[model samples]
Target: MRETNLDNGVLILSEKIPGVRSAAIGIWIRQGAAHETNADTGASHLLEHMVFKGTRTRSALEIADSLETLGGSLDAYTSREHTSYQARVLDEHIPVALDVLSDLVLSPSLRDSDLSLEREVVLEEIAQVEDTPDDLVFEIHSERLWNGHPYGRSILGTKLSVEGMKGERLRELHSESYVGENLVIAAAGNVEHEEFVDCVASYMDTVVPGVRSEQVAEPSNALAGLELVDRKTAQTHIVFGAEAPPHSSEDRYALILISSVLGGGMSSRLFQKVREDLGLCYSVFTFQSFYRSAGMVGVYIATRPATATRASEAVRGELERIAEQGLSDVDLDRIKQQVKGQVMLSLESTGARLHRLASFALHDEPFQGLDDVLSGIDAVTCEDTLRVAAQYYDPGRHLELRLGPS
Candidate 1:
């Protein structure tokens, strides 16, 4: 892998895979929902959609066909911390991929007519989430857990906010973001580092240098408690979550191990005890999220209303056991191997490597080859899990969220 930061501040990263004929590349802007003000709540996300509407040189229909004609694909998405525009194509089409990606970032035509049409599409997206109990459960939990912090805001802004958005604000957001310092261009596949860098320079040399708006100050108003939302649904959706260490913390490895032991797979304790032993729910899993200043870990479960209380209690029991006893040496070693396997297996695809490369750069993490990552996982000891579990996993510290028919 080779990394370069152009004079304009756009960081370009590329890796060559010897045996593959395909490549994955993307332009990542370090701006998203958290970067927005209340007045322009969904500008970042809305802009993500509008970029595909058209660019100065290409019509919407032409943009759609640009890569598809090459048998490749173009896509983009917005998250809480960042937005990405990406493409996957054969190595020979690398220039086409770069051209389309750079164009979307540099020259979006955010016309009022386009905004009007796309805003409704975004509203429909918001509605879909509200209607899905499981997805809605987490949205409610994040807003409640983080309270008034910017991180708590939904990626899909409310109807009122989206409707109020103007094309002017979106244009300002595009100019404010999508600049050199806030951008990271990355690619992985059968390509040479120098040649890929040259391709990127051709398209992105005109991009201006801009400042990065990273917030390192931790949230002081984080909340935790039981909150219930009444919704008419067949199955109760529950989300139990607690504050966690940020991305830079060494404790992150320990937390991952704890999550895996509890609910990472069918062989996990939650699956064996909750589903197999008690037959409480059809699905149960633990997930982890890390940000620059704040992070969270959660357990999601969907069960019939009659059995909701039992499932909640069962989950709580597992949390208690983990917090108190931590993990045995055998359990720790097994989970470590499990996590290592997952990390090693995912790198076989160019697309996965593309994301890994981009994420490490965005977060200011030093690049870790497979050995470094495997070693990090291997170095975690049983005692380390005990410390993190006790510090972050007190059942009382969690927000107990429930949504379903009453």
Candidate 2:
């Protein structure tokens, strides 16, 4: 792990797992949908789409062809708190990855034609999410849980925002939100540290604004017990959520443990009880969305319309039991081992390592090494899991979202 500061912005580049044939390069920008107001909602995600249309020296096809010709792939995504653009290529094509990333991110044209076309694409995407029950469930959950805050707003914004967004406004947001100060360039696998640093610095140095962002606030909200949507669907999509630790919190590991125990795999409680034993549903699992200022623990289950209520109650019962009785030593040990193994296994891949380094640099300090991560995971004990379980995994705080024939 290596840390460098370029004009007040931090860049963390980690080169682990030597001699790999492939490399992963990523840029993590701190600003996301959460940073937008009512007027500029979805600007972050829209700008993400616009970057692919054209850049300073590369057209959309040029960017695509650059990576495709090298036998590599380029992908990007925007979330509630961050946007990431990444490229995976052969180790020999590392320079090409950097070149394309710099051009798209630093020099996007955000042209009128591109903006107009991309806006339609994004609007269609928003409609797609609305039409899909699985995706729509999470949006409903967010709206019900974070009801009054900017965090509750959709990442794709509204019809009005998408329709009204222009080239100039999108470009302004690109400058304000995707600056060097709020960005981190990270690459892992078969790359030299000095060479990677030089490449990133050369591109980032051309742009000068330093890391300056508004103060982030802690998210606090009362959980709702019931939220239902009557839709013409064959299956019921259920989402349950509650407060959790932010990325920087000490309890973050505990949150991870809770999620793992609940639905990390076939051996997890939700899977074993809901799927293996009662055969209540075909799919049931839990996840943790731990962010910078706040977080949430969510459980999602999709089942036939007939068994939706049963699955919902079973999920609630599992939460209540865990909260009331705490995890057994045997169960806790199993989860700990699984979590540790998962962590170690992920380090083997360059793409996972690159994303991990970038994510940590944005939410916490850039210098948090894998060794530190191992130490933290190792330090977790059954008592630590119990404490976290008691703190944030309360059943009464659980919010439920159901989408189907109600």
Best by lDDT: 1
Q: Give the poorly placed runs of model 1, Cα more than 4 Å off.
A: none
Residue lDDT tens for model 2, 1-406? 7767776475656665676888898888887888888898888899999999988788889988999988899999998888889999998998889999888888898889878789999999999998898999988788779876667778998889999987888877777767767778888888778888887877788775655566457766656688888998989999999877678888887778778999999889999999999898888889888777788887999998899989988998988887776677887677778988999898788888887877777776545666777778767777777778776776678888899996
Between which residue pairs do clashes occur in model 1? Answer: none
Candidate 2 backbone clash number = 0
TM-score of every model?
0.98, 0.95
lDDT of 2 at 218: 74
| Every model: Cα RMSD to truth | 1.0, 1.7
How does residue 150 of candidate 1 score in lDDT?
86
Considering summed lDDT, which 10 consecutive residues are worst modelled in model 2? 8-17
lDDT of 2 at 110: 84
